[model samples]
Target: MDSTEVVVRSVRTVGPDTVALILESPPEFDARPGQFLQVAGEVDGEEIARHYTLSSPGADETFEMTVGIDPDGDLSPWLGEREQGDTLEVAGPFGRSYYEDEPRVVVLAGGPGVGPAVGIAERAMADGGEAVVVYRDDEPAHEDRLRGLEAAGATVLVTDEPLADSDDALDVLSEATGQVFVYGFADFLDDANDALAATGHDPDDAKVENFG
Candidate 1:
């Protein structure tokens, strides 16, 4: 939608390649899970705006995003350079937040894809939903955050590499009776969506987000 100025509030590392950013937005604006805001900054006289999904759950004027830093990645490095109090123009806490007050949920996150899924899970658990987080490469990707989920009463299922064929993942995913959310890179989109399909879940009951 529209853009607003936000100030950098903090930064923390979430994974080997992922950085979690905390931003202070206008008190009148509240951001939701799965929504991303475009943060724009000037790099060497050129302006760059990067869309980052909120990683931590918050309200009352704070927001977060877990961004993968590629050494050569333009938008990422620019975002990494921002510091506390630095102002950024952010627009549209955009994207349809894959969230509901449902009572049960299965969150499938692959790679740095845990960003949005973790955000979704946090909210679900707080609302008393039975939740599970299935992450690839486990602690290496989640570290203390996964522990936070466990503490919040979520069952975490982890798998390393060769991330089971789509079918195999589905076999494991079919156990959840409520909604399913699959979060991954762009390449995993269709396969994961199909996996949910094979489980007999309604396409509308499944939510998929691609971090390209």
Candidate 2:
């Protein structure tokens, strides 16, 4: 979709220093899990924009983005403070690493990357597919959603240890069967790819979206 003005439907705290921003979907706006929207707003007489991936499984009347609050950042902190009825500019459902009805999916996520991980996993299960999520975060976000996914039969493994150092996480990866996906910043991506390789998985085959 082109740049369009949308109203905030809600702002919810999903975990420590993290929020789920729900916005009214623009007319005809279609996006899948893992696709991203460039969100923008005016602050201090200047416009700032940031890209956030879909945290909601689908874009219906409203879509959601998970924002990691950063007081020092120009856009994230402002995004965290958004209230219902507030307006922001959103553009494009960008990126190529999106869910495509894959029958089996294994998502490796770190920090705020849990947004897309949970989104894809939910969609997969809803489509009668299988999902496994290996999330690494000290203070994990979307804990409630993670639990719900687990309850629904998806294999969810949450850990504070790096993927390269976590034996359980590696074991899961070694035994997992599915299309692989990876999301996070550069450092996390490095660690995740190393773990994938260590587990006899092909890193080049994984669909990845780097937050950086």
Number of the top-ranking candidate, with TM-score as the measure: 2
Stretches of candidate 2 exceeding 4 Å from the true structure: none
Worst 10 residues of 1 by lDDT: 161-170
Reference-based TM-score, model 2 = 0.99
Among these predicted structures, which one has the highest lDDT? 2
For model 1 the local lDDT of residue 61 reads: 71
Q: Candidate 1's residue-wise lDDT over 28-100, tens digit each?
A: 6767776777878788899888777777656567878787888998888877777788878888777774676
Tell me the lDDT of model 1 at 207: 75
* Model 2 lDDT tens row, 1-212: 88999999999999999999999999999899999999999999999989999999989899999999988999998998899999999999999998999999999999999999999999999999999999999999999999999999999999999998999999999999899999999999999999999999999999999998
Clashes of 2: 0
